[model samples]
Target: MTAVGAAAEIDTYMLAMPSPDSPVVLPQWISRGNTHPNSRYQDPIWSMAPLIDNPGTGLVKLHWKNCPGPLLDQVKLAAWTMINGQLRPTYLQTRGVQARSRSGGTDMLATCHEWMRLARWLHERQITSLAACAETEWRAYANERLSQVSRDTAAIICVRLANLWAFDQLSARPSGIARPPWEAEGVDDFLPAVGTAGGGENATEPLDPRVLGPLLIWAIRFIDDFADDILAAWAERRRMVAVAAAAKAAPAGWAALEEWLLPMARAGHPLPANSGKSEIQVATTYIAALTGSNRGQVSRFVKQYGLAEIAAERPGPCPLRVPVTGRINGEPWREHVDFNEAAELMKHLGTAATIILLYLTGMRPQEVQGLRSGCCPDPAPTADGTDGRRLIHSHHYKNVTDDDGNHISAGEVRQVPWVAITPVVHAIRVLERMVPEGELLLSTAHHEFHSRHGHAGALKKHTLTLRIESFVNWVNREAGVQGLSDQTIPEDPQGAIGLGRFRRSLAWHIARRPGGLIALAIQYGHMRTVLDARTSSSYGARGRGGIHAILDVETALAAADTAARLRDRVAAGENVSGPAARRALTAAAHTPRFEGRIVPRTFARKASTFLARDGIVLYDNPDAFLICAFKHDNALCEPEPGATAPRQYDCRPGCGNTVRTDTHAHQLRERADELDQFAAHAPGPVSKRLHANASRLRETADTHDATAHSAEALT
Candidate 1:
């Protein structure tokens, strides 16, 4: 056919094409219809094409046709053939044939790009089709790929090429073409083993307690004491707006009277338009002066009639000018409200509340962000029936997937226990007031720059991330100005704090805080209880999914760190405390010094299998005031079935499982001194009791001291 005739024919074929939303079979490629008949078929992975500069024009353009034209056309044809089940029986039986189910345009695009790269490599070696490439060429390509990108990336590239080669071989055999030598070869042989990418796991460090401490303390004070100021300010602004609207809608000459009277009202000047001198009295005097009316008439107009008009014409809600004054990181600071500041304060309040809930409840970031109005409407008594401990009902969205691997819209609501912290509950109530009725607590309003775009409902992960970063920056800046550098959350060396790190950090702190020294110093006694409950019971219940996985990893790391510390102490000849001191010392002696191996260190730290063979495992229990050298059923610390660790809160003082460090010995000394001081000041029975407690503390301290001296002498 002539060129013009072929062009006309192609145009007619395009015009006769099915709708993009409809599935239709392409001629010469497939006989069957699309697998996903209800959904539109797309050539996946095409959008990832890189833009390249046109060497002739120096202009950048998307290199859509960069792949070999004939090969590209053949791939497109193969895609249709695979989708419609027109492939050979051999191809149909292959495990990789399932790639056909990934019919999206992006998926096809990625496959096409990989095929194009292989085709280019073959062409460079003077080979034509994939069937012409030998094992040597494939090896060369694999080597080139490994040198260019990550092992995972190279593996993906090889896998895609292998799939395409398999398809090409299946197609060629039917057409009487010879198979390529590389066709039967496995890409797996050339590719490195790939595991799940860590992706910021190492980089996501927790917020420092030094910073979080003051930040939360300020947040509590802000929510408890200063949050009401926002409401009052809002009401005042609304009232002013209502008065202004009423004045505008007043009688024909009232606008002129208002214009004349407002200046005098603001200036505290006695209006010549009215009679009285005082500000309140001058308002009636101002009306009389302006309208040429008597004082009695003006008084009645101001009180009974005009005042009712202003009250009736109430305006819609207006932005509030909240008064903010606080000492961030121990430095006093003050801020006046304007439009931006008011919006910012509102956002800060929301973020503060979010931080408190996440930090205190140990809830995942998504779980906290997913919190809607009336989530925790009523706080009930905790499982233990503790007076101050309460349980909050909230939803968790992670792992809420349907049978088809799609996430359900609404999350599963679970009752979180021991949330009886008053400040946290108070923060929740404050958040309730900040948002409109039935709206999300951490809504788009918390995004100050984006609030004007209307209520976007629940906070997105990225939005919360940005807000947290901004919140941290604001706290740091405010604290810096107040010379409270010590109180400021320091910039992490790994990276800024992210939402995922909170739960892990809490677990780490609980498992590793030495003798509850830092925990007690930080005033997190209640938190220690919560952490213990979560680590012991909740960890196993959740089955190592989502946040539970992070907690498990951190817990293992904490255990390893504790073991390492114990080893160092033993090496330094420092005496071990507790009933299991001898066993703990033996285990410490066996712990191999970790040089530069992370995987082995992680294994040694987390897994008790090796330690179990020797009848010992170092268990961290900071709240128990000593580490536990647990020996399964023989543990002096009662071991709960199906629980990997002992309950620190239920720790027996003389339990053979316990192993105290030097810090514990120091604490005993301090306690002895404290008791002695109390006994000296007490009278009669109290004095006798105090003296007895002091003597016990002194004896324990002396025992630890003597052990330490003996170990030193032996060394």
Candidate 2:
């Protein structure tokens, strides 16, 4: 049925859409039990408590606030036409277009907005509908649709509807609805952009200063109704997919311009003979502009981010014919790291987004090279019983208003929820304050991303090799050479941690929680079934491996047991391992007495499939995993007296096999990273000490290696 056909579902959302201008009276208690369908939303202190025990009807205060502008209003209206009015119609049109255009039945019809994002978009426009046809569902808008005026017409309808809605919300225009009785007296022209996409109803698009402004915003609001996601994904994984990331994403600037020019040369691309006047020489500059920033911002970001001049200019490491430098743990290996090489360890943090992605998600270098400004939300969605806008929605990945302010881009944007420890919330808030509306939310652009989808560009296309092996070597080079061999720079475990691990690992963590990924992962996947339908790929051939790696089940089990003994010892008034004097034992070596306990990566995958930037799954060597103690897994890494020391339990000695030292400590010298994922939630001081110890442990290991080197030289 057409969306117009499913009128009832539309009212399921819109009866509460609040055209109410003044206070409307209602009974003290709601008539029907109200179960807000969105599990993502948490009840705020000031908000109505959703009576979920029984679903029902209840009237909510309808004070409107934070409305959009005239043009924005028009755009909102247009958006409504397409999203609500033409929901089924557009799907039919788009479906026919897809079928007729190519027999291939391409996957391009998928919405750029994920389930929750689309839901949020709909809710904000006051077009809240529970109808399947009204959902931000798939409609193929290909080149065929692009050629058709209806496609643009649909987009135009979307923007107009959204603009008007935002304006009404801001009180710039009159609200079409009535107000509720319970609202306080001072609330006039009440407009709230609550639960809006981009976390607000402002609807500002990031555009380079060199370009036109307001009209551009209009173009964005009008044209970008739902096409950005499709376009961005197409750009990222398009004809470009076959190309390796190293080539597409290389930091190539001037030095390798000669070779990079070959692609254009092959196509006889345009370039002025004079590099200065020529766009080719300034391709990076253009990339910044087209991507909604000034040339300077893009140039500075690319340079500071240490991008290669061209793919070929990217640095490469010379693999050893032999272990020229030394060995780690008596194995044939590379250079040694000095752990006590320093006293009190200090770590300088980068921009919070970078640091968080580095510290929390464990994303890698090139993968993060092109963080499209603010694609990662400032405050992730929080579950502390508040409106869910604080949650980080994932649509930022597909399109973020490119240079012309009329284009799109794609990739996996962060979908992190805000049910985190306080510091993470603060860090998120800090980011919100710092970001400019049209600017990239990231500290610096790692490379020039001219496409609609920013980072989806392969690194190798710009010129270096793109394999994970190459990525490993590049990071290893810094650790092994400039930093390791010279000893000037201390070892950073985060260096070895790359993009491949985060989604799977996070999935594993989520899987172990009570309600499984649903309860643990927080926020949502639009609806229940969307998350549950992953068996095809998740446990399927290409996907199961990722679930295996997400959690180190072996580690968790071992860790759990260690905690129990420690607990029993405390209860019995006995010291663990016959503790005599002071403090409880460190839990770094908690051993789960039960063999069956495991971290639930499979369930995590089922829950967090939306998070995987690419469908590709990550796998870990089965031998590499072990059970974990909750505290030890989260942090509080130390040895339990009755349990084996983390060091003692190693493949040999001093190991947890994490990229960290304790995680990194026993394996301080290894390149695999074990950066702090738990620090965000830790009691501040203890977390600091733990990070310090990890850094220091690496330094000490470095020192010990240095001494051994000196001894060998004396011999």
Whole-model lDDT per candidate: 0.52, 0.28
* Candidate 2 segments exceeding 4 Å error: 1-359, 362-372, 375-446, 449-483, 486-498, 503-715
Q: TM per model?
A: 0.60, 0.23
Best TM-score goes to which candidate? 1
Which tens-of-lDDT digit does each residue in 297-391 have in candidate 2? 44564455433243223322211112223233343233321111100000111122333332233233333333333443544455784543233
After the best TM-score superposition of candidate 1, give how far the Cα of residue 566 lies from its true spot, in angstroms: 2.6
RMSD to native for every prediction?
12.1, 24.7
Worst 10 residues of 1 by lDDT: 49-58
Q: Pick the candidate with the highest lDDT.
A: 1
